[model samples]
Target: MIRPPALRPGSRVALVAAAGPLPPGGVERAMDRVRAFGWEPVAGRFCRGRCSGYLAGTDDERAADLDAALADPGLDAIWFLRGGYGTMRILDRIGWPALAAHPKALIGFSDNTAVHLAAQRAGVVSFHGPHPHTAEFPDFARDTFLPVLTEPRPAGVLPFPAGSAGRAEALVEGQAEGPLLGGNLSLVASTLGTPFAIQPRGAILFMEEVGEHVYRLDRLLSHLKLAGVLDAVAGIAIGAFSEVPDEGSDGRPTVRELLQDRLGGLGVPIAFGFPFGHVDDNWTLPMGVRARLDAGAGTLELLEPAVAERG
Candidate 1:
């Protein structure tokens, strides 16, 4: 995988809204955070634009903003402002060749999973981390994120919070090493049969979601199973599925039971409740980088640097 240049102190970071419209003052707050990190933030032309009820702008508008950001050599990274929906609409519209020619770190998760999958298919590395609109930018998130972008070394060990019962558990205890892949479960499932569909073969698939009911989760997991994703992966890392109800009616299983029923028999190293989804301490994960999953140890460690050193 091609690693983008490490983000220097003065590097320009383009903030774009490739999905739903940004919340009021969302762009300002994001810009503030970027400046706080000592990097210059360049807002995309339509980053704050709103239209079509849910979309940030028309498909062409959103795509054009992203295309411009990717093509701009001055930009060291493109940090998505938010992720709600509409990414699929502009997925095919992105200039992949241009993006590949001027590669920069693409950061965001949730709906931005569409772009991350596309980046993987294009053989470039992107980042799955807290978006400006997703979290409150806790110290943990900043500490884990800034170093990966500014340093030229492996991200090292990523373990769940200490003494937190929400820490990851081994569903299938074992060890596996492979390039990290996957994102929001809903996006992963929705991309099936498309060019951007996640190819989990030989990858440590990481998945997370929010507000999805147990039955829906079951159906999506079933889809992946039937699609051969479960059997092809080197391992599995499950992240937070926040807002999923504890009960299901009509004889349906609860979220926990559904996860066990669907993924417990995968026979691969499986770690659940990883700290990378819609959580306050969402750690930045470098997609397409080789990483080790020690399910028994409840740890994921990147084996190589995610960014290229300055020449």
Candidate 2:
């Protein structure tokens, strides 16, 4: 994988909302995150100023805005404003290969998963991290966020937050190593057979979701199985499935039960609830970089730096 140059203090990070419109208070928090990392926040016009429905702008307009940022030689990184919906619509329109020519860290999750897959296809390593466009930025998120980008060395084993919220359990016992791939479950599933479809062969597959019912989660995993995505990965690390609606009285499986039913038989190392999702305590994961997943130990460790020492 082509690691972008290490994000240093004073680095200019372009802020983009390629999917959803940023809430009024969201942009300030995003700026605060940028400043917290000691990077200059360079905001795009549409991410904050305009929105056509849930989209930040029309497909063509959003593509052009993102392309302009990618072409800027002065920019050291591109952090997404938020990931609600829309990046999948403009995936083909954006220039992924050009991003390789001007490689830099691409950071965000949720709807931004489409862009992450595109970046991986272009052979550039991207960060599956929290967005700059957020109404709330928790302190726990910064524990690993700042160091992973600023330090050029391997991030080592990631630290989950304290209490029951940080607990991760092993679904299958074993250890596996490979490049990390995958993001928001629905967004990743949406790219099946597309040009930017996830190529997870020999990769550690990670997935998470939000606002989904148990059945919907089952269908998404079923989609991956049908597409042979589940069969190709070295291991699976399932992140938080936040806010899943309770299915009352039916004989339907619960979210955890559904996950175990679908994946437990795959015979690969599997761990459940390793942070990263539509939650406050998100760990910044570097996609396409080598990593180790010890399912029994419930740990995911970076094998190498996600960035370079020199540009």
Candidate 3:
């Protein structure tokens, strides 16, 4: 995959609402953050527009905004304003040929997974990080974003804070290194049986989800297994399953137990609860880049810089 140039102070970033519409005052909030990061913010036409209860605008508007942002040679990056559930509708309208010819960082996650798939298919690395509107957009997300997006170097160790458990836990031990891949589980599941399905051979697969019960999570994981998605990766890093029920869940195994049963046996090192997810402390992870997975030690180390310097 092609590494996008690292963002610099003078770089311009376009804010586009490619999926769900921006919430009240969301555009301004995101713009403030963008400027705070020392990058200029360029708002797309749909940045302040809205459509139905969910989408940012009509698929046409979203597609036009994305295409225009890509064609803008002056823009160094395109930060998706928010992600709801409409990115898939405009996949065909994206004008990928243009984006492929002029690659740049397209940052987001959740519904933005569709765009990340497109970037991968086009051979450009995309970021599976926080959206501007998500609470995860600031602290935890910025730690990864600031370094990689500006003064990038090989991030040798990725760490998560110790929780009430008071100590870091390791689900699987030892280390397995490979390129990072995967995103929201539901989005990944949506790609199954589709043309854009993620193919993560020799990859350290990372995934997270929110608002789903154990049964549904099991179903999605099962689909991945059935689709041979799990078998293609070298290791797995499962993040926080937010709002999920605790163990003793309707006579079924808990989310952690369910994961242990399905992903644990992939014959790969697996680690659970390493921060990044639908939460306030999500880290920015670069997709399609090599990283070392020390599952037993509770760490994922990036082996190389995620962005390249441009002359």
TM-score of 3: 0.94
**CA-lDDT, candidates in order:** 0.89, 0.88, 0.82
How does candidate 1 fare on TM-score?
0.96
lDDT of 1 by residue, 1-311 (tens): 88889998888999999999987889999998889888999999988899988999888889999999999988999999988999998988888877678889999999999999999988888999988754388877888888888888997887556557645788889999999999999999999999999988899999999988887898899999999999999999988888876456778776667788999998999988788888888889999999999989888899989989876
* Model 2 spans > 4 angstroms off: 49-52, 165-167, 247-249
Write candidate 2's Cα lDDT for 1-311 as tens digits: 78889888899999887898877778778888799878899988676645657888788778887888888878899999888899988888886777888888999999999999999999999999998766667788988888788889998998888875444688998999999999999988999989999998999999999998888888999999999999999999999898888643377777778889999998899999898998898989999999999988889999999898974
| Pairs of residues clashing in candidate 3 | 21-55, 21-56
Where is model 1 more than 4 Å wrong at Cα?
162-167, 246-252
Q: What's the lDDT of the predicted structure labeled candidate 3?
A: 0.82
| Per-residue lDDT of candidate 3, residues 138-241 (tens digit) | 56567867887675678778756435342235666768888898989998999877667788888898998988888889899999999888889888888878
Query: For every model in order, what is the number of clashing pairs?
Result: 0, 0, 2
Worst 10 residues of 3 by lDDT: 161-170
Question: lDDT (0-100) at residue 129 of candidate 3?
Answer: 82
Off by more than 4 A, model 3 = 134-138, 162-168, 245-247
